[model samples]
Target: MAYRIAARHPGRLVTYTAETEEAALAKWEELAADGVPFEMTDADGVRVDDIDLEDRIDARGDGDA
Candidate 1:
C-alpha cells in the first residue's frame, strides 16, 4: 500500500505515492512549506487530514514481512 498526495491547481491534479506515512507526511509538509496546497489520502482511499500518522502506515502483506 502507498500514501497518495494530490495537488489540485486550476485544471490539473498532481499526484505522488510514498511507501511510508512518514515520507508521505514529509513530502506533504514540504509542499505546504513551499506554498503548494494539496490533500492526502491513504491506500484505502481515506482522507488523512485528521488521521494519525501511525494509523496511516500501510500494513505489510504476508510475504512482504
Candidate 2:
C-alpha cells in the first residue's frame, strides 16, 4: 500500500510518497524529529495519526532481532 505524507505552510504544501508503510513511518519519524507538522494518509486516503505511527514504530523496536 502507498502512503502519502504532507505538510502545509501558510501558502505552500509539501508532500512525500512512500511505497510501503515502514518507509512512510520512517519518514514520519524524520519529520517529527525535525519538528515539522505533517499529515499522513494510507492508500485509501485514511488519515494515520501520530499516535498510530508511534505505536508502529515502537513495535518495530530498533530491528535488533
Candidate 3:
C-alpha cells in the first residue's frame, strides 16, 4: 500500500496512514527526524489532491506528536 502525506506546514506534520501506516511510518519518522513537512488523512475520507494538510492540522493538531 502506498501511503500519502499531509503536511500542516512547510516543515511540520499532523497525521499519517493506517493502512500504509507501517511503512508510511518510516517516511514520517524520517521526515520528522529531518524536520520536514508532512501529514495524511484517512484515505477513505479524503483524496491526495484534496488534502489540505496545513489547514487540517492548523484546525486540529489532532494527530501531532
| Model 2 agreement with the true structure over 1-65: per-residue lDDT tens digits | 78889986457889999886678878878888887888899888989966776666678687784
Ranking by TM-score: 2, 1, 3
- Give the count of colliding residue pairs in each prediction: 0, 0, 3
Clashing pairs in 2: none
Please report how far candidate 3 places residue 25 from its true position, in Å. 0.8
* Model 3: residues with Cα > 4 Å off, grouped in runs: 7-19, 46-65
The candidate maximizing TM-score is: 2
Residues 1-65, model 3: lDDT tens digits: 34567656555455645454445555566777886655544556555322343344446546565
List CA RMSD, all candidates: 5.4, 3.7, 10.2
After aligning candidate 1 to the native by TM-score, how far in Å is the CA of 60 from where it should be? 12
Which 10-residue span in candidate 1 carries the lowest summed lDDT? Answer: 54-63
The residue-level lDDT of candidate 3 at 64 comes to: 69
Worst 10 residues of 3 by lDDT: 48-57
lDDT top scorer: 2
Model 2 is weakest, by summed lDDT over 10 consecutive residues, at: 49-58
Q: Compared to the true structure, candidate 1 yields what TM-score?
A: 0.66
TM-score of every candidate: 0.66, 0.68, 0.41
